[model samples]
Target: MHKLTEIIKYSYNLNLLYVEDNDEVRNSTMIILREFFKNITVAENGQEGYERFTEQKFDLIMTDINMPKLGGLEMISKIRETDNEVLILVLSAYNEPNYFMESIKLGVEGYLLKPINMEQFLVVLNKVIQKVQLKEKSRTYMSLLGQYQEVTDNSLIVSKTDPTGKITYVNDEFCKISEFSKEELIGSNHNIIRDPENPKEFYEEMWESLKGKKQIWKGTIRNKSKSGKSYYVQATIKAILDADGNIVEYIALRSDITDIMNQQKQLEDLIDFSIKPILALIEIVDYNNLSKFYGHKEISHIETVFANTLLQSVPNKKLFDTVYTLSHGRFAFAKDANNQDIDEIIDNVKKALHNVNSSSFEIDGKVFDISIRVSLSYGDDILENCTYGLQKIKKGHSDFFIANGLAQIEKKQAQSNLNTLEMVHTAIKDSKIISYFQPIVDNKTKEIVKYESLVRLITPTNKILTPYFFLDVAKKGRFYSQITQIVFNNSFDALSKTTKDISINLSALDIEKENVSNMIFDLLEKHKKDASRIVFELLEDENVKDMNVVKNFISRAKKYGVRIAIDDFGVGYSNFVRLLDYQPDILKIDASLIKDILTNDYSLSIVKTIITFAKSQNIEVVGEFVENEEIYLLLKELGVDYSQGYFFGKPEPL
Candidate 1:
């Protein structure tokens, strides 16, 4: 009680006058108030209180309504005439309706009755303290706000919006970042900051989190700054709340560190330059950075070492590229020469390098030993004008012979990839290719609703060759579109009568070709009835490399009502979050998992998970390799809606 009274006591330079006719009540209150308050005066009667209150410039006036002479109500009304900002409170029997109604016009902040409970008095007194502190805090906040505006007004982006996530106010920086001016963006959502490369999942996750009461969130954001310049920043978003605990606005603080990001990139490039050509069989796929493998400084050092060794070695008729160690003890390569017998070439070169090491180069301080290999191409490896056939030799492996550049098989495989391309081309020219069908069944209906048309080239020996034999090669050459169109036409002709839809996989390469869409639309127009019975199976192959192309193709394809199935679903590096972007009608689950769908719980779980995801996206599921009764039954039980394989039917002559 005492502490609360002391805290509420006035401390300003303005005058304070307290009136209480009771001697004890007046004396104690005056002493406590005077201890913390300045310019204090007391009046025994309402008359004196009014006189003193009018005489001085007071900030607060407290009095009992039951006081003598002029009475509290009359004194208060007179005081109200002189001041409005001054806080007024009644401390006596002030519960009467008339007294309150009249005092209300006097702006009394609080009123307490006679014989006040100490606890209630303390609560009311603390409220007065709060009011004073609130006024002081408000003034301080205003001053700080001015300083804050000065510090960040020019650099930071400031935006204010109503509770609904629409933009209401945007500063210069916000306008600069979003490229939309205050006028244009005021009613827009914050999506203008979105980047093309950003995955959809991040936004989905963000919105999900934002809907909750989370105060702030941290995430790496990629946004297009006003001038269509993309930048990355670590952003923190905070929700500004009102007194009722409802979010009224959101503030985003983003710092541009594009230079720091670029420096990090350079540092990564430097690291790659130092330790590449790892000689280890681990696949490194940072699709953004591939040229780092060609380490200029290290490669040059290796070349010099090999060059010195070549200079010292006795010249021979067999031309070969050779590498020798130098000052850094790092060795590299034999330059591809015009006439190098690459086979005997590597051995003689190694011998020459060894000879130089033994005779002249010293065993220097902390020298690193090095091993290298060379490759050879003689007959078909050579193009019509070119002479030698060594495509590439990896200076790696457990095979010591390979280290010594004597791996005959390494040279043979290079010969095969080169030979395979020609063989595939010759096969296509000869019309050895045959169309095969992989029945695509509706798992829910347990029937073949579609057939995914596959292309195969059967050798005269009756060996069935998969499309892999020629597709990659054909895609590289100009023959892909012809083969795709032929397959499409053949499949349509084969299924012209059946109610079942025939899906044909067109290489994104086919769609990218000139007149592909026109040709398809023309073909479909000729077979409008047949086209509805067809599904153009889309694969995220070459098209996935550029999303805009894929989106454009799908958007155009969708207009034909032919239904699009994402072929080899969940098998590629497609962003699953953006799966909705393609809006596929069917998700042809990849055969890699379908091949053993039943026995492996892991594969079953994955298929089930994909089905659940696809269901949400309104995509039908199709199983490819339903080879046995058990597999078929298991997939059906596991909620797989489709089954197609030897168990149901195989591709036979139409």
Candidate 2:
């Protein structure tokens, strides 16, 4: 009513302590408090309130000052000694100057008159809530900023040199990159890392560029580490000036670019031998789309198949030395063959790729075919030419070879993927990824029975992105495992506090990874007693190559009283015998089968068969995507135990 929208939302999440001596007043105020805060701790007097405060944390506090057995001021004094940030609101009957001064000195949030009027109380409460919210937001912002800063600092080689070019300071990253200890670097000349590869004129030009305090010198520098190993860095070096506008010191920030340089050299080596090196860039087609349907491990397996095909097709090991994968969905290789013979080689490679493309990848029992497109370049600069060809492929010229005119694309898709991966890493590092829950209701009783936990990426832009959008890139970047761990820990911890069961989906690839598997088992063990409330749903599409691994995981998980469910039961292999062997507690009929179940007899038949089979095995059946009352009622008649869909409720944050 007061248009206090921000404060109201913040209050719903915060915990508050209200301390008062009078029972009637406390009860009356608590009725209003319950409408705002989710958790409210009440105490009879200041001493008891202080004890409660010590045991737990609260975002805000409200207390009456004139209470017996230790007044609010004395208790608050004790609290302020240990905790200065918790917002405190004091209620008092007196308007005494001394009381106001003492309260202000103790940093109390507000002083309100006793026999509190509802309208006036809400106004003061709103102000205090705003303060609490602002402080909380500030803390969260600083924490995430700190995490990003730490990552950035750890990655870049940082160093400072005095005007005379002697090293004044160096970060651990600088020492690490240079393979030198801090002591070895601090007093050393900056030229200690200079390499012979750079000409004398290059140093002269750089010094001239830095003659002005603000002029930034940027270049690729070849430097030798302490071990005498040569490396290259893309560096930005500039002077730090003093009040007099004179250069007092210089600072440099650089990133290692040795791999790219090595790749270029490898290309050059092939060309100088008169072998007529050709660069071929292979990209996994629809890799992001595939990741939505599959997992990272499966994607890796598919890429391996593509590589093997390339080697087999080319057969001339001397011509095609090694196939290097740059990132997920992208690969590069060089062949020592001239343009005259390149056509025939391309035909052979295409044939091989076609053969592999005909076959399908089986992940979590689900089978799907993957295809790759190739771009070839015979330009003088291998890296540049290859990247140009890659750009062509990205622009819908995939599966073809190019021999000329290499123009750079404005923004490379691979660069975009890299940026997304960085954001994901930052989110995970800051604990910003979170779980959203959707209700699963009993079909017959029409009562919510459980929830399905879905993971979301909270982007730096404050936009919420679903798994299908970014999960593929994350999986390719080897970040899927970390995300899985975050979702598991947060979801299971939340489930442990409630009686309602919740289901979490896990990829077979996730289960196959020893580290991720162990983390899941550890969480299960931690919530062992409440394990019955946890359900692990494995999609039926993925092929479990190692049945024993899945069996072992299921057995151990079941031992903790957790239940297993076969998700999307009608998709992929859909093998009943295999399902029987896994003996999942719940069979979630695929949405594709249920979406058409009402109008398509074939879909209905499949659903009936799945439900009948599940019943025979004493497994409960859940029908997904039951959109309308007709489907809901039909599912109830078909003996479906539970149903989840937009009809019930969309997935939401808790």
Candidate 3:
């Protein structure tokens, strides 16, 4: 009884279609049918049964042989034309051999006598159920296999070989990467593409792992393509085993690493022969602006013309060992300084650049005036020092500067950066990275509405250092995310203790990092109730590369009722178009603009324009650096929504 109950429970999930013309017979069978199958569709005739089959899928069908308007045998014949796999059984009163022969020809699983015997019905239904279970399992396995094949074929170079290491299958990616057709690759030995540069020992170790130990082998390999060009792959090879644990075949998956390998080799070569102790870098002035105005192709032509003119101007090419093109319209001429007169080379380079600048460059019949800056430095870190000199020249009126003086300053700065980085590490380890809240007030009521969380690092001596002292160094050391996390956690803790809303700062860099963004969203989900009181102040110091990322983040944040504020609205490429895209809730005027708003008309005019724009968009404006009553009152009169500065309260622990 327990065994039969288990069988019936298994059949409960299967849908069955039962057709019988007699209403009395159908009602009598329904009692037993409902016990075996929970989902049973009853059809009065063969035509109705065929319609039900067409409307929906059924795992099993049982029909009486004789019926009006299409007999059961004819319906079975029609169904078999489309589907040969559906399980069918005949329950008929006719005991003629022809009926049995017709049922056999129609592919019925069983034929029961006139009045069905319950034992005989159960025995035959069990066989049909077993077949259904097997088909379902097979279908599921094939679906999973197809999905795996799709992913592997799209993303990787996949190939399979027999136990004897003869290639039997290769995906399209493998053939494409190797520049070989499937016909050319199949049945070929795996060694056909192997580079001779890889020693015999390497192949021995790989095969030993696959054939002897039946373990996976992973390595970087250099293989030659059909064109005899070398390529690199990071490969993983594993042996497929039979049930008896004997090797059946081997499958290999590889990712092309040719570019990465080539880059490493180029770096190695550069280090070996290209670097020199003394270097001079010549850069075109305002190259970024030029590129922006002219576009990349035109600027590239201009760069080529400039480079050719420089080469022509320099008579003694031997003066520099190698001329390497650096990025951003800069070229470095490097040479050893052991016996070379660095000043003479610098003077000659300066003269060459002067000649190049005097010449006019024409593109598409449009003439352009060009200027150049030159920096000369002698040190182990020649490139870095020369770059520093170029930046200093961009600030001043000098066209040429020897970077020896700047190198001393750079050495001190490097030491300072190292010290700051060490301090950041220590602060993080000691849990001294903390946040201080500065009150932002409602200008009309002079009531505190929210606070901005500022990050501060406490030194071992308990001295509080602002981001200016360590943030850039921390970013270089990859500690910026850790610091942002700490400040975020501390700010949230502060939010829990107070009712006033809290704002946290996020830079474009922070938004670009996946882990940081994930951490933020996870916290928002965890603290659902407090999300409405939270605000994110986007710092505009760095340009955001992908507006979509920021837009998506803002969209998700708004879903949790969190508001966004554009920090430092009047500076660093902040424009109206960005304003529309971000649709921020508040705009904070930069301190530089707000500090001199009282005396400087230009600053006042800019502030007025910003406030006017914000008002038009219905965005609140916060005046930062409101040091005294005069600035606060002026801002209030101008209809600014909020005020934040030392006048309200300096940033301090809650």
Candidate 4:
């Protein structure tokens, strides 16, 4: 038969990838693709091809189901996740019906038999092109949907109310902000949301503006949600006038400025009842080299002395305000910027501090001068406000300008809610942080498959301290390791006490450092039963470096007969599409997807697609946060390998 090279050249030019473990088949396949296509990428196994896919976008992916390092089904599934539009045609030598059905489930455009098909390959490409085009359009639509959602879900509550003060329509975003659904709000008056904090005059002026057909009226109103959470909404309302010069409806756009108002109040407090005198960032600047640079001792001393000097000279300083030491030996202080000339004040203070550093008392009969740099600011302000304007004073000093670095962390509010988090944190430290386990059941057997360790902090003072209370703080510091240890130790201890397999979380940090993993391994070796019964559900975002820390830990754990699974894939920072690339033994769909899986067909479809993809890779799948029987059944029908949620049982301590 004539070479298919002429046929492909005359039709469309493209690069083709052929991946299979068999050396004979690999070479033969490469020759065939090269005959038709000028560029043919070949890999010995699916794993290498999968890595190649990440490095480059391929027009077509052709692989056999059975391969050495990784399987074709897995690579296909991973490819389908990100670039569904790409043509994925499986060329397994075996005509296994299950493999074909599985391929079809993952949106595999086409499948071809082995012994190579030049004629059949061209035919399959035509079919795949159509599916790929359709898939591309669908992808674009989904992307557009996401953007539309972001716009509609602006933090502000935008609503339209009639001149009669009756609420008429509200956007889903507004409903979410108000915690009231469209059904609960359509006919209800805006008064339903008016909190007691909002004065009666607020409504009086709002109506006056609506009646007069005013162009705009701006005001702040306290609104109460269905959950009774009070929110301050900054709103701008306008008139929608008819041709008759009569106001028919109103247009209102609101932003929930609760956090804004809180910050404003804090700034106002800093300005008024000013006590602490410093709000500045101090950095050691030698420009090129900062290691053991000038001002090392001074910077350290500033941490302890700045407060004392500011208080001694101006003794009204408040001790409660915090100081932060950032990465790269940068120190910062934030407080009231009311009275003092910060530059001149810091200048004099810098001179005095310089003196302290310059004169070193006899130390081992040798004198050494301490060199340091001090940079000060009134407040560590937001980037938008401080950086927007051209202010020379803000960038004080020539060599060591104020390192006005923007911070993303939410600073502890001066007063309220601080103790709530602290008390909760303390409660957890004192053996709280309640943990429970829910049985991961088998899909086919419906049997209690495994128990996944979970945690909640129960305070010593008869209060339930939730993960939200301390997790963010815990993640910010070195506390993460100890926290992970607690979870693992308790989980292992609980498992040893019970007769069941247990899965525990390994903080991404723990795996990266391997401190906790090695510790656990040592303990498990001692326990004898600990290693065999453990499953580590790693977060999809678990940092993977050159060592592939998470993968290494998984491999090490697997050597001990333990299983590795990716947990909460697709939520937070994790790109779950890549999670499929790892092809863990088990994949747990995040609770966010399962939350509205009942009503949200998109979420259900994702669960179904993930399940199909996982099964084809010889991976089991689990659905988390199934709140009710409806969610459970929905995931079960979708063929999710396991289901864990309140519908079956809440996480309970053994």
lDDT of 2 by residue, 531-592 (tens): 88999998754456677777888888888888999888875322434564577999888999
> Could you tell me the TM-score of candidate 4?
0.42
List the candidates ranked by lDDT, beginning with the highest: 3, 2, 4, 1
Query: Which clashing pairs does model 3 show?
Result: none
In the range 163-228, model 4's lDDT, one tens digit per residue, is 676888898667887788899999898778778787788777777766752648887777888888
Q: Which pairs in model 4 have colliding backbones?
A: 279-377, 280-377, 294-371, 294-372, 295-371, 295-372, 433-456, 433-457, 434-456, 434-457
* lDDT (10s digit) by residue, model 1, range 296-357: 23333433444554455635634423232321122223333335445555565456545544
- Candidate 4 off by > 4 Å: 1-425, 443-447, 570-583
Evaluation by TM-score, superior candidate among 2 and 3 = 3
lDDT top scorer: 3
How close is every model to the real structure, measured as TM-score? Answer: 0.43, 0.45, 0.49, 0.42
Per-residue lDDT of 443 in model 1 = 61
Badly placed stretches (over 4 Å) of model 1 are 1-306, 309-372, 375-392, 395-433, 458-478, 515-517, 572-574
Q: Model 2, residue 414: what's the lDDT? A: 71
Which scores higher on TM-score, 1 or 4? Answer: 1
Task: State model 4's lDDT.
Answer: 0.64
Candidate 4, poorest ten consecutive residues by summed lDDT:
382-391
Query: Roughly what TM-score does model 3 have, to 2 decimal places?
Result: 0.49
Clashing pairs in 2: 363-542, 363-543, 364-541, 364-542, 364-543, 365-541, 365-542, 365-543, 366-541, 366-542
Given candidate 4, what's the lDDT at residue 288? Answer: 21
